[model samples]
Target: MKNVIEDVTCAGCCCVCDHIQVTTDGQQIIDVQTTCPQGQAWFAQSRQTEKQQPLIKGIDASREAAIARAAGLIQEAQSPLLCGMGQSAVDAQRAAISLADLTGATIDSGASAATRALQQVGEANCTLGEVRSRADLIIYWNAENLRFNAHHQQSLVPPGEPVPRKIVTVGSELPGDSRGVDLSLTVSVEDEFEILWRLRALLKGVALEGTTAGELASLAALMQQSSYIVIFFGPASPDERLFHRKLEALSLLAREIQAERRCHTINVPAAGATKGAEPVLAWQTGYAAAVNFAAGYPRFSPCEYSTVKMLEQGEADLCLLIGEDPLTGLSDQAIQRLQQIPLIHVGPVPLVDLQPEVYIPTGISGIHAAGSLYRFDGTPLPLRALISTQQASEAEILNQIETLLKPVMHIC
Candidate 1:
């Protein structure tokens, strides 16, 4: 028999479109409708891997032995770090954090830079629903492809809008022509920071003596004409060393505009492993990411506790990867450093080719296991299981690991 599930949510990206319909056979997903190209690929999962058994040191082992070896490693390591919570389910991350507490391990959510920016200077945020219905003007700032949300353009800028919504873009790379963007202001990569700060000053009526001030007035004039404006920011470039400062400037600019017109700014990165990791961390640890529990209490340190920093400095003795991202976008040196460590991975097979010391394959969330996934706006949605699988879920694997370690370690 085939089951046609309704109102299914797509975990393909951070967009988290919740109005999908999925057709699943007893063993695999047959069809997924009302989703994007990425979601379709994620739902069907064309590249099928054979069922894997738990492995220890490149050698297949019993599930019991794999868990025992993993617990033993966690117990023996002096400086263990648990990274990759962004790829797991909400219920699963708690288990990972509990295990970290028991073993005095640090956890990185991969949102270290963004979390730090939010903590330093909070963002004026709005939901996708509000942006679609209420916003009269939309600004895409240093953002490309609107964070890879294929459905956002149609949903937000629907046809027959009363006022013909104005679209504005600011960045070195701006999309035009068919995107229907009305305005494009170009800023050099090196000068983006100065331009944003100058615009904020211009909005404040601060007198300026240069042509740069005149150039900024046009954007300010646009802002003054709109009743509701929302700025969508993409991830900072890897070359942007002053990312935090730029975020601060953008946030303050939104805040400044809010005094006169309702204005908001947001960051909606593409959906991936660490997509919604910040919410769980903020609620559980009082900080968003780059958290350490070595003292048996959570401590926030963006620079020190980051997974990249730990690998780069060779500070971590053991790594417990608990999500599906596989640690992509890391420097080659960091990737090479991870190869040298004792790795205990409890989720999907990593994309990179580093063999693990202990491997426990898990069913993909929203495909074989049900859980909660957060949208880009931090709205939590129900993720339904589309097929039956013998493999355990990420949450189950992490919980089992935590349960095994409780008897051996002291948990205060």
Candidate 2:
């Protein structure tokens, strides 16, 4: 019998488009509707693909047997690095954190720069619903971030908004559709930081020397005139060179404007399974990522404990890689370093040009397993299991791994 599920959530990107509809034949997904191309690939390809088995150093092995070897590696290593939670469920992320805490490993996700900036000044954040319903002024900071979510433009900046929405784009690189922009302030990445700094000065009625854009003043005027404003920003450039500094500047500027009138700064998520990652990490370790638990207490250090730093230095003897995402998180240098270390990978997606000491292929949460994911707006959403599969879910595999190490680690 064919089964139809309504209100299914898409796990493609951080947008967490929850209005998707799926049609299944009890064992495999037949159709998916009301979602974008990313969702289509996420739902359909997950089920249509071939299954993978557990491996121990290029040889296939039972999960139970592989767990023992993996536990031995954990036991033998002096310094261990636990990384990647991009594609894992919320429960899985918590489990990974627990494992890291028990094993005294340095845990990090590849994408923690924004989290680092937010930790410094804190985010002026709000829901996507609020942006769509109320915001009179919507500014896309980098605009390139919009490519991650196909529905954002239509969902947040739809036409026929009760009042005409004044659209503004900052930075030289804009998204594909530049039709309705009220003002497009084209500035180089180097000058972008100064633009936001000047805006903050204008907001405070403080004058700064050596002005760049007359358009900066006009953008400030729009902010003061508008009833509510929302700034949507993403990675500054492909390399994300000065991303952290730029983000800190943006946060400070938004805080200044928010003092008088309503303002929110929302981050457009990168294309990754890392939604709700920061929230979960913060709840568990009191820090988002780049956390070191080797002292048996969570230590927050962006420079010292980040995965890139650890990998680049080849400081870790054993690496526990959990889950995968399309883009964002691990960089080329980090991946090269990870290759040098003994790795135990547990998740649905496979790594390219890399094999692990232990590989346990698990189910995708929204595809073959039931779990919870988050939207970019920090909204919680449920992921429904759409089809039957042979493999275990990510949460279960993580728990199993944690169980094996607990006895050896001797944590009460």
Candidate 3:
């Protein structure tokens, strides 16, 4: 039995739950406490594998061999793409940035493209802190539930005295539990288009064309009642562009509402961290087009250089995966291309069919590793390590890789 039982923090997901507890027997971990299944699986080794799994070209290899091969691939490739920097330590991320500079490669995080767009929108918008503190109306569109991703979302509601706030869910159903909310309105997910159309019509003084008069009246009543509003949209599907268009329409509606009453609006997409970080990074740097441009001058275009398209066309030869779980989240086509290429992965092993050519597992950012992580509100939090372990830290590995790659690229 272990003498010391400690409450450890979990930063595996966006929720950043700090109530995790664990007990270790000497060097081996024995028990975990207060953690959800996701957290437990993330920290515990479930498989009956005695040794750390290492593979190359669908075959097993020693850690040294894997590292050497990965380095060689990067040295040879002309346009190596250093992608997915969100999950790794800040040091690893910086190392990736350095690698990109040395290799003249494209370095980007997951949602690099979407973040570009969000940054543009954010320049004209208020910070999330301001919204949470001030906004009275909280509207969620196409967001099935927040309990999974952002469990603490419910706590955003002001407790104790009844502050006049309206919580309207513009999706299929209302939340099963609405303790602190004053209003819980539901809209149909099937006729989302009609809902938007009705909202737009009401805002523009245009004639409505729908048979659901009662529903329309109810929506109108909520709209009129709201004083300060904030909309949250989930990017569960690939129809993000369409969702953005709908959000713009919603924003227009908010503007019209603001003409008579004070109001604000925004959409919190799935990649919340990048959403907060990208705009500033872009403004400080430039659009990704400029950042990733290989030619003499910087270029900018939305449709041109997305990761999905780049990988789909079989254009990428060398891939340096940073923070994302490519095996699960990415499209199958993209995954196929990734499998074909010389892939170098750094960070936590994603729960998916990786079969990576070189997988150098790094310390978990914001938890096992110390670094800066951007909160949903654009606030940068400096995460410090609460405990130390045997694993080689991400920052050290990144430094080593960068050093090894320097002479190969003739960039000291």
Candidate 4:
């Protein structure tokens, strides 16, 4: 018998698209109805046979044994780092934070760069619904097409909307489809900060001495005429410093626009659970990301508490990676350093190249397990499982590890 599930959340990307309709047949997701390609891929990959087993030292092991081995690694290490909360559910992230506190480990998300950048530039944003229903002028600033594709564009304007929304793209590369974008301004990524600053100045009618003033003025005129403006920024650039500057400029521009009219900035993060992880970390530890719980409390240190920095400095002897694969996001240098340490991974193994000492297989959120996830706009959505799995959820695995570590923690 086939069953249909509606309003199923997709934990595929930061978008957290929750309106997916899943068709399942007795513990298997037969089909997924969603506009996002990533969401489709997430549901398709959930049923792969390779992702259904727990492994200890690359050998198949029981869940209990794998959890025990993972706990042993954490217990033996002087400094253990917990990373990769971006792919797990919010409940899993909360459990990971608790485990970090219990073990005095450092916690960081895969989207730490974007999180740090957001911290540098305070948020002046609104929900996707607000942008769709009200925004007249939409700006894609340094937006990546793969992450923010045509589906996103459709979502913003939607179908049957009579309001003629003017879409603009300001980035190094012009998006593939010019039909979706009303205006395309191609500027090098390095010059994004300057362009944004000049545009903001032009909007405020304080422009003087610039060859690009005419272009800036043209863009400013659109912003001035629009009732609601929404700027979508994708900050997944290779250059970290440049990304920060872009974010700062975007924030400043949003503030300037808000001074005159309604303006909202949307940060399109590259990780799946980044939107969810930030709030869980903030509510539990009083900080957003890159936190250390070694002092018996949360310590905010964006630079020092970062997973890459911790690995680079050799401060953390053991690493606990949750949900996502560590090799996927880590830099080459960070991966090399991680390979030297004792690593415990609690999720589906995306690749076996950088195999951890212990791998405890876990179900994917919103696919094989049901939980809550946060949308890009920080809105909580229900994640319904489309299939059942023998593998434990990331939260359950972390909690079990916590249970095992509590007695050892008390003895110390």
Clash totals, every prediction: 4, 2, 2, 0
Instruction: Estimate the TM-score of every prediction.
Output: 0.93, 0.93, 0.78, 0.93
Once fitted onto the true fold, the runs of candidate 3 whose alpha carbons sit more than 4 angstroms away are: 1-9, 18-35, 45-54, 58-64, 119-133, 147-150, 157-162, 172-198, 211-217, 239-243, 250-284, 288-293, 296-300
Q: How high a TM-score does candidate 4 get?
A: 0.93
The lowest-lDDT stretch of 10 consecutive residues in candidate 2 is 268-277
Instruction: Give the clashing residue pairs of candidate 4, or none.
Output: none
Shift of residue 324 alpha carbon in model 2, Å: 2.0
User: What C-alpha lDDT, on a 0 to 100 scale, does residue 12 get in candidate 1?
Assistant: 74
User: In candidate 1, which residue pairs get closer than 3 Å at backbone N, Cα or C atoms, i.e. clash?
Assistant: 14-271, 86-273, 86-274, 87-273
lDDT of each: 0.77, 0.78, 0.56, 0.78
Clashing pairs in 2: 86-273, 110-329
Off by over 4 Å in 1: 46-50, 157-163, 176-178, 207-215, 270-274
Q: Kindly list the per-residue Cα lDDT of model 2 for residues 13-104, writing each as its tens digit.
A: 77787777899988888888864776788876675334677899989899788888888888888889887787678888888888888889
Per residue, candidate 4 scores C-alpha lDDT tens digits across 1-412 of 9999888877787776667789999778888898667778888877673456777878888888989999999999989999887767888999999999999999987556656667777878888888878889988777655335555655666556567678788878875867766677888876777888888777778855766666667788888889899888875565354465667777888887787789988877654334647778878887777899899888988778877788878888999888765545566678788889998888765446778888887788888778898777777888876777887789999999999999999899
Better of 1 and 3 by lDDT: 1
